[model samples]
Target: MSQIDVATKSPIRQRTQGLRSRIEAFVRTFEWTWTSAVLFSMALLFFLLISAVVMPSFWMYYAEQKIGWAGPTDLQAFLEKPFGTSITNPLSLEGYKQVRDAIAMGLTTG
Candidate 1:
């Protein structure tokens, strides 16, 4: 009696006794359908989050490894194209500036 009285300082704990009997209480009020739905929703949200956030980086890595991987010749060509002899090449005329540029170059657009 003395130990029990010492344990509880608040009147709120004195009323409930913490409802320590979990087995009988859960058996009376458990809803399986609602619990299953909550679990399924959590699983779906986890799947969506992983696919959306984590999968693109994996796809990009695989794509770069598959198609966009550049050879030494390819990179060397890119760097060497801008470093060649001073060939006075004009812009090509498949653009909106084709006529005006042809006129500037003293070339016929026809």
Candidate 2:
């Protein structure tokens, strides 16, 4: 080939070589920093989000199974059940007084 032909091809060859070098560098950097804990935490968070989003559906299904009924239902009965109270936060003195007043009002009115 002529010198001009060689010169014309040189820039394309250099660009392809540069691109390959950059890709290899990126792969090396990623491989060096990748960790199992990071991957595990990402997967765990994904499942947690999925579970949180699906929990209401599961709760409704269970309520239907227990009652032999289907379709939308009141959540209050599920909230007021004995196991419901187990999830309650322990009250501070001020919080206890507030809850007491609320309960007292609820009881007196209905």
Candidate 3:
């Protein structure tokens, strides 16, 4: 196998650079009007709203399923305790809160 030096660019690198340049040019030439700005904000907000609702619901459902227990039979119950099912799953809000609390406790106690 040959070594790739800084001066020598691979075909993949060249293609990636070309794509990046095209994207940059498009962004530079984009017309940012008030309507466009509002539309963009609305689209972003819509995406956030969808994700905020959907992702948590899925997470809670999956976590409950994985734990082999009947947790949060309804959406409202799940929303009320979003991280309740995450006691065993460390990738959820409860995990984050526990970690934050532990760090704070350590800092204050020391």
Better of 1 and 2 by TM-score: 1
Q: Would you estimate the TM-scores of all the predictions?
A: 0.30, 0.28, 0.49
- lDDT per residue (tens digit) for residues 1-110 in model 1: 68778586566656555564665688788777988889989999898776665565454444345644222223344444533233553322122133333333342211
Model 1's alpha-carbon lDDT is 0.49
> Model 2, stretches more than 4 Å misplaced?
1-33, 73-110
Tens digit of per-residue lDDT, candidate 3, span 44-105: 98887766666555644554566444332344544555564445663344444444444434
Looking at candidate 1, what is the lDDT of residue 104?
30
Show pairs that collide, candidate 1. Answer: none
Off by over 4 Å in 3: 1-7, 65-67, 72-110
The C-alpha lDDT values of all candidates are 0.49, 0.55, 0.60
Question: Which model scores highest in lDDT?
Answer: 3
Residue 81 in candidate 2, Cα distance off native in Å: 18
Put the candidates in TM-score order, highest first: 3, 1, 2
Q: TM-score of the candidate numbered 1?
A: 0.30
- lDDT score of residue 32 within candidate 1: 72
Q: For model 1, how many clashes?
A: 0
